[model samples]
Target: MRSGNPVLSDSTFLDLGSGAVLSRPADAMTLNGTIAKTGFLLFLTVLTAAFAWNQSISPAGPTAAAPIYMWGGVIGGLIVAFITIFKKQWSPVTAPLYALLEGFFLGAISAVFAHLYEGIVMQAVMLTFGTLFAMLFAYRSGMIKVTQKFRAGVVAATGGIMLIYLATIGLGFFGINIPYIHESGLIGIGFSLFVVVIAAMNLVLDFDLIETGVSHGAPKYMEWFGGFALLVTLIWLYVEFLRLLAKLQSRD
Candidate 1:
């Protein structure tokens, strides 16, 4: 179940307290929780923006194109990513900012999809929660363990999927269409199924990270970071599910 950094494991830092150093183990779970909660709040802010944007429309449907505010979310997410990866030292502040950006992106994406497929948003939300809870339960019951090999496989698959998606998007700039994407074809459905599995596995990894953090007794700030990671996975899973369901519906 232990992936990532060995230093993060059992790592202790010193706090300068009244000229005396106090040693404390890193509480990653606390950071994770805080990050997750902050991410939710950020998501709410974006949700509100999405709601306002959608409400301003004359026609209420998917045909209504995603606007600038939606793009803002996407751009914000990218910025957050850059900050998180490069400015790792600023995570205490940057992590929360990343969550807020992620929230807006998710909210905007969800709104767009909800408009297209009637009641699909609710379905996706329920499914997301179900998958998350189910995975947590399984992990807690000793039914699942995130082995190094498993983590490697999942990460590789996730990377492949993201690359393909990015390529598809790039192609659109030249007016190229990748046939199966956004289509209700068998290929599209299969891709969705594969991604869904990957996303679900990611949840397992996230849970492992959280448990690892708690066990190591990481600093309280780590809970936010842990939660943030989990939230990202959940959002990704939810969006994928929503798209998959919509494609199936379109085919029907």
Candidate 2:
């Protein structure tokens, strides 16, 4: 399906013409692409809305969000995660939903940060996109490669980061604050930098996966799936960049 011509659309996967090729392989890519794009688009829309609202509310008060709005995003993200895990076959639908929910969560969380650090949200977004494009260019220029060793190391580092973050959150339940989590300090800056590196490496994996899907002649929908994965990674990288920049500015 992906061979021959480079028609970039999801409908190309489903041919109704009599005696036409089934193109199952093409369907795979198309499905993935559609899902990824749909999810990411929905997420961006929601995120924009949330960010706008957050900006509007900032002048009125420090903490203006309803608990339900915050909780809705949290619960929704969990639900999307569960659905994606249990029903991989339904990624076309679930993936985009996850993006929407995550957008909500991110927008809300970002709002909270905006309260403490003025103008940080915008700064973070620009940095995030900037980093994403820079990494993409590096990969395309052969400056970066997704080697087996690199993949393994990045995955391991990412897992470690997730664990540490979870631990930090859990500690919060007991009213414990790991020093420098929000403070401007060497440790905090160092941690943020590390996360940024991991996040950038993740883009390598994302690029490799997309190329693989395309090489295998995956269906048009696969673009959506591919886009979704990249979007998620970019969002994460952007937030970390935002936090790091904020910390640096606070220190100055």
Candidate 3:
């Protein structure tokens, strides 16, 4: 099944090239290794994110620091993420770099939301992880099946959302605002809720895809690649949670 995650769904595993260089048992991807790599990457992300968060909340304020950390992270993270995707073998190094860079962007934006709605970042963080574990539980217990139909539906929805975002950003250059965005209205809240659900569901797809890769005896370095793909979904989920929480808080 094609995963909704861009990195994973790009058919990276399919690049095994007719299995001539199939991984040896001792050098194949494993669940434990992937989990460990993921945890380590998360640690790097949080460490840098804390630093960026502190910077954003400093006397300089978000506006003054936005270009430095925010844009730097955004641009740098994308560059590294693309490099990792195109050169999956380089993931061992690029994955950690991507995480650290992504943290800056996440932290700066989260600080902006926190500034607008007190306690929002903490609440969003909680909800994001809560959804992650909940989805993991559902997946492991077979409560959530990653059927072909389910994967296709998710991919379609995610694609539509990406298009919407692209259009919104494109229009922003012309000073056009999308009505359902940042309005704190019923539509805005509902839209955010939907995106959060989709983001959470992508985790199930990621899990299934990772298991598939391991079973196929993918190279061990794929552990890092898997972790990087997961981080992409998680960062997306967390940002969506922040937006959802902020919208709900604004209604109060």
Which candidate ranks first by lDDT, i.e. highest? 3
Tens digit per residue, CA lDDT, model 3, 37-132? 999999999988988888887543466675588889999999999999889999999999999999899888877887788899899899989998
Candidate 2 residue spans exceeding 4 A from truth? 1-26, 30-48, 51-56, 219-221
Query: Each model's TM-score, in the order given?
Result: 0.78, 0.78, 0.95
Instruction: Give candidate 1 misplaced runs (Cα > 4 Å).
Output: 1-59, 62-66
Candidate 3: lDDT of 144? 95
On TM-score, the leading prediction is 3
Ordered by TM-score, highest first, the candidates read: 3, 1, 2
Cα deviation of 170 in candidate 1 (Å)? 2.0
Each model's number of backbone clashes? 24, 24, 0
Cα RMSD for candidate 2? 7.1
Is candidate 1 or 3 superior in TM-score?
Answer: 3
